[model samples]
Target: MAQCVTAFKSMLQARLLEEKLASLYRAGGRIVGGVYIGKGQEAFSAGLAVHLEKGKDVYGPLIRDQAGRLAFGEPLLDTFRTYLGVITGPMRGRDGNVHRGRPREGMPAMISHLGSLLSVVNGMLFARRLQGRLGDSVGATSLGEGGTSTGAFHEALNQAAIEKLPVIIAIANNQFSYSTPNSRQFACGDLLDRARGYGVQGYAVDGTDLTACVSVFSEAVKRARAGGGPQLVVGSLLRLSGHGEHDDSSYIPDQVKSSPLGQDCLPYAESQLKASDLITDEEVRKWKDEFLMEIDAALAQASKEPTPDPFRENWRALSTAGLVEGQFEA
Candidate 1:
């Protein structure tokens, strides 16, 4: 019950923050890059992240994973800083807003290529195993169903299976890959089939159901940590908004939008929490108010911070002087 409440709170906070980001982007001069929000997918994203142990477990969140990032211990201020291009953000304002991460803290800075994050997490877990520091620590990464079609996803899953690494590959089957539908992406009957083909344990859940997401993800994490090799969890839902703030998502049909999977998870999650006696309407309202204030303060502070000054910045690929040229080859 406590875990559910916490996850719900993270989802709520993420929704609020993303809404603010979208507004800022619409205002025409705030954000540096695209604004991507995990609208209908927050429950699934937060569910997996809430089970991860910060500093012990690793997570690589995708572009639409603000909820997961927060549940995995990312600061709310950092989101604003990154989007506003404040130099003090995790990316030091050098990268896109969605690409911010702290590698030393187990979250790798994201690359825009689809399916690439799985390999990155696999490498991190493999490195830890080689160092004899793995010790039941699991690494997890999230991607869309479309990413599953990439070669990187196949190679990483195969590597993890061969190595028996403890990892979770979360797939948000949101029905469409941007404007493209699933029918065009793969011929498999279900995504779980891909897991079976890879010889990894697989689970399916309703992405719109917060309780179901939490339950399934908890079990998946447990299995992975217990030496069950990689776990693939595919959650079915719909992307409630456009791919980014720029696109209007007119490509999505009305019948599809009205489907049960298309329903927004946020309200459903709140209702579940209330009915379970874990939270009340008053409490939910209070949380929203508090989150709004925090977001306002974060944005205000980040807006006043200076962006990176190119004149004072080091543009070299290697920042350390000792690593230069042939001096270190010996």
Candidate 2:
């Protein structure tokens, strides 16, 4: 009951923050680069993140992983600071929103190229193996359904299987990659079948259901931790918002987008909670208010962070320790 409440709290906070970012972007706030929301996939990411051992297991979170990242201790204020280009924030306002991670803390920042995340995480897992600490480490990463078709995804998965690395490859099969739907992406009935070809275990999950996602991810993480090798997990969900705030996501079908069952993960979880009698309306309202207040305070503080100083920022972007005198001039 406690874990379920925490999971719901994480999801609610993630959803609210993403919506806040969208609102800020629309209102011409300090947001730079793109604004992507993990609104519909909150349960999936949060489920996987909560199962991993914080200081021991490593994972790379994509843009749609705000909840998971937050659950792992990424500051909500830092998230806002990254987008607002605050000098006092992580990335020193250098890396843009959600493109940052704390490697020392086991969260490798994700690259914009979604397909590359798998290989990067696999390498980290491989490094642990080389150090003979493989038993102590497990890795997880995410990609969209479209990314599975990329060469990097196949190569990484193939290598992980052959090496018997403890890595979990999570694919968010939201049926569409940006404007392109699954039909145009691949002919395969399910992405999980690719796991068989690679000789690893695979699980297809209903990403919206927090209980199911958390259970599956927990099992996979435990198996990997026990030296059972890598697992491929595919999550099927809907992209409630656009690929970015700039996009209206009009390409998605109206019926699918409008369907509460398909569009929102929160309500699904709420229904489950209600059915189980695990929560009351008053409790839910209290939790919601708490998260909103927390977020409001974080954002308020984040907004006060000033932009980086141009002169001080230039040297910060590139270290001068090993550079030649002439190189510094440029």
Candidate 3:
């Protein structure tokens, strides 16, 4: 009961923060890039990641994954610092967006290329096994439904299954790949079917139902950790916001956009919490209010930090210093 409450609170905080960031981006705040939000998909991230070992099991999160990052122990201030490009933040004023991550916290930095993540995560899992560190350890990575069609995704999943690597591949089947709906993406009966075809354990869940998401994801994670080989969990949700703050999601059908399932994850989670007698309406309200206030303060403090100047910091990123100085040319 206590763990459920804590997980719900973390998911709530991440959802509120994503909404706040969207508001700031629309108001012309100093967000250096697109603000991708995980508004309706918080449960999959928080639930799947909260139980993993902090520094042992690495998980790569996509742009729309604030909840995953927070669940893995990222500081709220660090997230704001990353988005706002604070000079002292994790990325050190480099890429100012969800594309950044802090691996020291068990969260691997995600590349923007969606289909490519599975391959990288597979390699990481293999490396862990080689180092004899695979005792109940698992690595995870995610991609949108559209990503399943990519050749790299196929290669990664097949290889992972063949090697019997401990990895969890989450498919956030949010109905659309940006503006493109599932109909255009593939003709597979479902993503789980595709996963099964890859010769790995596969399951699908209602992404909006917080309890269900957590249960299925937890099962998949446990299976992977037990050397049961790779498992794929596909979560069904909607993209409540635009692909970015700039692109309005008017492309989504009105029927889907207005459905109860299309609503944000908060109400669904609240209903479950209430049904389980885990929380009260008053407590839910308090959590939202407190989280908003906390984010506001964090953002205000982060905004006061100096903006990163590339001239000063870009030099630090140059890995081939000796080669650049012509010392290695000969």
TM-score, every prediction? 0.97, 0.93, 0.93
> Could you say which candidate leads in lDDT?
1
**Candidate 3, pairs of clashing residues:** none
Q: How much is 301 displaced in model 3, in angstroms?
A: 2.0
Q: Kindly report the root-mean-square deviation of model 2 from the true structure over all alpha carbons.
A: 2.2
* Candidate 1 collision pairs: none
lDDT of 2 at 250: 88
Full candidate order by lDDT, most accurate first: 1, 2, 3
Q: Compose the digit string of candidate 1's lDDT tens values, residues 194-223.
A: 889989999999999999999999999999
Residue-level lDDT of model 2, residues 38-73, one tens digit each, is 989998888888777777888898878988887766
> Which stretches of candidate 1 lie above 4 Å from their native place?
322-330
Model 1 per-residue lDDT at 188: 94
* Candidate 3 vs. true structure, TM-score: 0.93
lDDT of each: 0.91, 0.83, 0.82
Best by TM-score: 1
Task: Give the range of the ten consecutive residues with the poorest summed lDDT in model 1.
Answer: 321-330
lDDT-superior candidate, 2 or 3: 2
